[model samples]
Target: MMNSRDFHRSPSFTERLSGLSTAFKMFPFIQTGQRILQPFLEKFGFSVQEVTDSVKLFLTNGHPALTFPFLRPPNNILIGCANLLGSKSAPLQFSPQISQFLNESVGKDVVYVSFGPYVKMSGVSWYSQLVEILTELDLRVIVKVDKEFEKEFPKSVLPLNWAPQKDLLRSGKIKLFISHCGNNGKMETIYYNVPVLCIPQFADQPVNAELVKVKGFGESLMKEDISVRAKEVIAAMIANHGTYHRNMKRASDIVENEPGNARENLLYYVEQVAEMGNVDYLVNKVARQQSTVEMYNLDIVVPVVVIVIVVVGFILYVLLKFCVYFSRKVGMAGFRKLKNE
Candidate 1:
């Protein structure tokens, strides 16, 4: 359920450094939380970190394009296939109003906007501004908001508390998605090959939003800047729609045809453990047995680092000694020659 990058082993050096710095900065808050929870967790016989460490397997629901494309996870970890590729027998039924709106907007590009259920924009100052911008766009617009806010927008726009998001994205009429960039929404858009205009609110949404841009399937804007930049960003994405389409289409193809099937992988592992009656072979014994120091290779790292420093120090000492000896000898010889002259 975590972002794949959190578990990814081989990040670029700069990214690794940045992660290390973040860990350091957050260490104090982490320690404080641990201290507050230590007494309560002692009753359960393990700490917070131990919960994840004790797990025998981690099943992630995403394609390798969003996970580790070039590398495989350890035996204990399984990258499950994208959920969109799974069962879709019961498709979401759209309301009559929404259905009619889609029908009338035929032959025109549609933009689907939803911030997800968790985020409420009713109190935000920019909500009205966003509605105004949506009203002005010539493209057909479908926005998901509370029913109370529905009256704020013109009749041309359709505002519902909920939208058949997956169905609409799959409808092919939706050329762009305006989203808060939640993980599930991002994956759905990717599955549907629709470009996104991300205005992330918080948490993993920002990370997902950045990846949208990095993957070249979309662009991102800060939530605060949306009131000012939303119109321009939307127009630009629509103008360059082809490039985004191609990028997302490639991703969709990879997820559908990726070498290891996500569902199959999960089922196989479960069946294996059930038949064997234990995960002995699957578990990394050394990893589980090791303390934090050894787990990070800090035990080995510290000594190796000390050895390197000592070796370099010894080399510098010898070089200095030789230089001093040579200089003295040359100076003495010159003095003797001068005395003779």
Candidate 2:
């Protein structure tokens, strides 16, 4: 679906995923994007005969998804967000608690912002500036920082270096989740039906952010114009909860309503792997290779081209010889007639 055209709306006019074979690896594969990764990682000349594409497998076992081409649907997958069922890496251990900041929550009043482990804040000043901007817009924000972060803040802002992310998002007060849009973060934000405000830092984050934007549940922005864009996006997400929440609910419903849900699918494959290092029957043994001729069709096309060129050249050479021979024959006959006269 990705490497084709007219179906997906590209963010930039010049950017098209259809031409980029590895681009799909960044799209949400309805779970954690492990499925997308296998194809991409394999494109690097590494032969990974993977098994599944859903995020459930990765989160549950840190497993790479299997490469099953036929079974996957052509359209975007519809696994519900909540099927993850708020499974946090740990519990709600740190907080002033998200609940404490909820009196004005219209789902937009409070925002949660954390750049995951990979993205470092520019410095303490940048962190301070971010907190100041949100509070200036009359918003309640909790920023996850380091244990040593000691920025002074107004009572409305809670700047904790750490907090229970799943707990905060589950709190009804959390209207928006501002993050780097990592796959795990995407799963958590969407599963809880919390809308997103993404500022992607690196790797697949940009692709993940684009996925969120396309889903109609959230918005993505460049790191530039931080103060203005943050205010603009936060206001929009809060004010238009009707639209965003509806889309979020629809996506979650699909996941939650699955007959046994994603967990069963993940377990099914995992158990099979345990019984046999891999289920030989399930893995596609056919390599997608083309014989030198089958791949480029050089055997057929090359010979045909060569034959045409030879035939054309031969005809031209004969035509030139005939013109030369006929002209000489006429000249010799004319000379003989003149001598006789």
Candidate 3:
């Protein structure tokens, strides 16, 4: 009784009701439902093959499927700010304005703190407690306070809404980072080869925190008893400087060695796909050939030759033009001399 487009546009009453019911339920129920439905859908030809193929492609390209790519085998995932070869290890630089203040306050013993952007300090009472404990320690603190806590903390606390985090980490002035254990921050700390005191809020944070402890980079504190835990953890971090530095160095090495820049790798893959007309076999073959050519230094030779030729041609053209102009001038000068004679 309806056109095809109209029929497709209209959601079934049953589906609408089901969606409404799901919305009213708790978050856990929605997650449970998704988990249950995912396997069923995959089995019923929803996305099984596509998912498998995509994962295979990533793995084949030297990417890790689970865990931080910078942490484990294949060792081709790029996720840090340091050079992998460790050829040029240097201290991180912080904003000059804050650096002066930090140097004056803590001298060579300052602590950096960040709980990530999403984790609000207002909703978490432990933030205030942690601040108080850090202040009591008489340590110079660079705490990245969220918008909610901006007015709450005193001006002298070095409270920042956002910071040049990587630069600060690389700065030798920062002795420790109190983090939420987010992967980016974790990787940054690793790249800077700095120790961390993780205060996990939720999600993968607990897992990351555990890994940090396991890897000996640093320790984690309970979010609830932030003050007490932070005090103990900070003491531990300061005392056991050797282990943290060593672990961070090792992590930095791995991160630096990871294969492929995200942009470069992604564009390479996309270009490959387009060039090969989406033929998987052809794409693989082309990639293999390109790798071989690169290894053998074959592809570079032609481009270098072309560049040289172009440069030489330009120089020759200019020289020829100069010669032609001089010849014409000489010819005119001889004629004028003869006429004058």
Candidate 4:
């Protein structure tokens, strides 16, 4: 059901921010110290007031924004809801499929390559470079390319139009993931405890890639350097597999320990938003808080008062000059009359 048209009709920045603010209002605990920026929505001429109104409507109407499956409640407030499949209780059915593929391989050295659902390799020049790099590497590759590019790849590169990615990752054969850094791909990589080589193309992919680096899960490569970087990173990942595995296991454990199921988390926030009705209370609370105190705060207030005083003094000076000129004219007229008499 998701198509190019649906993708192109993506929500504006204002809409996204408003939705996030509403989510935050619904669950204030989700707000980390980090500021959430919604400038893109504002750039399109959406005022903060208008965005707030819309968010109010969405919350009151019981139409919380669609979220991902893996997201749990307080986590949802912070991370927003993930797709349904991403839920914590979601079955680990995909892992076995990947395991079967790995069992067929002679060694436990395999690379998983996927550009994600939204991205395709049919016309992209990088596809050929990726193929060339994988051919040179000492590992088997399981690639998920567009159906159109199936014939272009070699036999060693196990090409599928659409592969069971989650299953494949859990198969234990996959040594590293050459990914486009999609959320689903990132989560799957984390869930299966697989190391990644992120090649982010657009949207929140760069953010996800940064997260990967921060988490010590893997390296990020520029799309332009797919050929050279892929080979190098792949070699490094293979060489440091033990470290990668350790980091991945740690991340998985952290995710697993989080409280509540993804659905329970999502519904809890949604119910909270319904109860709160609007973001007015949250916004007011934030506005009233003093971020920091400054000694020169009073000095800033004094300048406006000084400017007003100067403007009023100038006006009075002009009025007095006009009165003097009129009085002098009248006196001169009287003196003229006396001389005539």
Best by TM-score, which number?
A: 1
> What's each prediction's TM-score?
0.69, 0.61, 0.56, 0.59
lDDT tens digits by residue: candidate 4, 74-176 = 1113322233234445555644545455667666488888888767688788876776787787577888887677456555667776787766676566788
lDDT, model 4:
0.61
Candidate 1 residue-wise lDDT, 204-275, digit = tens: 676678778877989999868867788898888999999999988887777677766666677777787788
Q: Write the per-residue lDDT of candidate 2 for residues 32-148, one digit (tens) a residue.
A: 455446567786655333334222223231111111121232222223232454353335533345455554454447878898754556464555766777888888787777655
Between prediction 2 and prediction 4, which has the larger TM-score? 2
Error of 2 at 182 (Å): 0.5
Off by over 4 Å in 4: 1-76, 79-101, 260-263, 274-284, 288-341
Of the pair 1 and 2, which is ahead by TM-score? 1
Least well predicted 10-residue stretch by lDDT in candidate 1:
1-10
Pairs in clash, predicted candidate 1: 81-262
lDDT scores for all predictions? 0.72, 0.61, 0.62, 0.61
Q: List all candidate RMSDs to the true structure.
A: 8.6, 13.5, 23.8, 17.2
Give the local distance difference test score of model 1.
0.72
lDDT by residue for model 3 (1-341), tens: 11223323333434334443333333343344346446777766775435433542332222222122232112122323422234235555567778677767654567888888766776566777787777777677788877766446554468888887877877666778889988778766766778988887766577678767866788888887674467877877887877888877775655456566444555665576577655344222222233444423334446767999999999999999999999999999999999999
How much is 82 displaced in model 3, in angstroms?
Answer: 8.4
Top candidate, metric lDDT: 1
